[model samples]
Target: MTDGAPPRARSARLCTLARCVALAVALAGCAGTGPGTAPRPSPAPRTTSPQELCTRLVTHWAHRLLADADGGYGDYQSMGLSNGQYEILRTVLDAGRAEERINGAVSAKELIGHQIARSCTERYRGGGPTGGPWQ
Candidate 1:
């Protein structure tokens, strides 16, 4: 339906309509919540168990220490390992070394993994150290 309007007038009307539509869309988003609306609750954070944490730490350091015989990673405290974890590492490494000599590096690495998992599980079986905090 032409209203005998000039092209400029038609274009201006279209522009105004577009602006109104945009404003309506923008306002619709903000209409979801009012002043009385309560905020959504966030999800609770997940926590790692002591056994799992010990397993990860021991596994990481065991691999590194096994690869480098020069003790390049520093002491137990520097490596973020407790005394108990360090003892586990030493025990695993000794077995790992023997395995490496007889079977190979691959076999020794596999043994390290198994030993670390088993030892860590046993260590945290009673909900972690009983002797002291450092244990």
Candidate 2:
């Protein structure tokens, strides 16, 4: 009931008032800028270790060379390999080939992986090459 309105009009006014209150509450919630509503900090960037990078490079080139039936070493400079990495690749491939002959292709692939890991770790143990950038 209202002072000058009929019962139906009073109900309509109450409904509109309720709708306004609900809208204001919803907007207030969206406008919040408290600590809990702050944007989350981005995650730290991931970094690859030198040894891991070396292993990846050598392993990728080794697989490429092994897959090519022509048995070409290709241009190491064009392959993005450092001098040291190229040497590592050559050594690993030699062993890989011997392993393939003795065991199987699968054994050779496994040996390549192990050798790359070991070689890269050893190469980077002293904080990578100090001779030059391409070493």
Candidate 3:
């Protein structure tokens, strides 16, 4: 009999050891990119005029709030509005409600168009109140 371990046992141990070493080496080559690694940013949403933004967001939110008798107001953050922007929206919506009552939804929509452009122009006249590219 061989002085060392049996041939099959020795081969099995060597094979397992080799596989473990190969796996370790393979894993070592792959370092996961976690924090501190700047990942490619996703494409940003297409920007439009402040008036356009107001037009889009205000109409949507107005409908939502009006749909519920509770006037379930949504947060500005959810509506993608800043505090200043929301104030403008509130004023616009208030006027729109009056317009709608007197005329109809059509008149209200026209009012929104005019108010959004005027309000946004005023709100953003001072170079949009910030230097960020969001403007």
Candidate 4:
């Protein structure tokens, strides 16, 4: 064995390196938003009209709906919403237009839900009361 302990140490190092490489590949594969899928399209230019702003705010909430944990947009039939409604909500939230429209009147839930359900008029249709308008 000459002056050294042994050759087993080299094999251990090789095994560790292989494990690291395999782990890295597995993680990269799990990341669905990995490279080459195309970056998300830029949001629409800011609007100057008040109505447009309000509508945008509503659209933001609708998109945050929790149809499934996996983030699938639901068909209006079972979910009681149309594709337009789902698209609007997702668009508004993605655009980050709510910070401008919401005020002291909005609650965390209300604001968030409104932002999420902005376009889910059918699923969460009817605006009667939400426990004193977020107060």
Best-first order by lDDT: 2, 1, 3, 4
Which rank order by TM-score, best down to worst?
2, 1, 3, 4
Can you write out model 3's per-residue Cα lDDT over 1-135, one digit (the tens) per residue?
565998899889989999999999988766455567766688999878665666577667766664456765668888887777777778877888888889987887778768877877776666554544433
Kindly list the per-residue Cα lDDT of model 2 for residues 1-135, writing each as its tens digit.
348988899889999999999999998877756667885588999999999999999999999888777778668898889999999999999999999889988999999999999999988998777578788
Score candidate 2 by lDDT. 0.90
Better of 1 and 3 by TM-score: 1
What CA RMSD would you report for each candidate? Answer: 4.7, 6.4, 8.3, 18.9
TM-score of each: 0.70, 0.71, 0.51, 0.23
Residue 6 accuracy (lDDT) in model 2: 88
1-86: candidate 1 lDDT, tens digit per residue: 98899999999999999999999999998885779887678899999988899889988988888888784677899989999999
Candidate 1 lDDT trough over 10 residues, lowest sum:
65-74
Q: Give the C-alpha miss distance for residue 16 in model 3, angstroms.
A: 39
Candidate 1 Cα misplacement greater than 4 A, ranges: 1-41
Candidate 1's clash total is: 0
State residue 83's C-alpha deviation in candidate 4, in Å.
3.6
**Preferred candidate (lDDT higher): 2 or 4:** 2
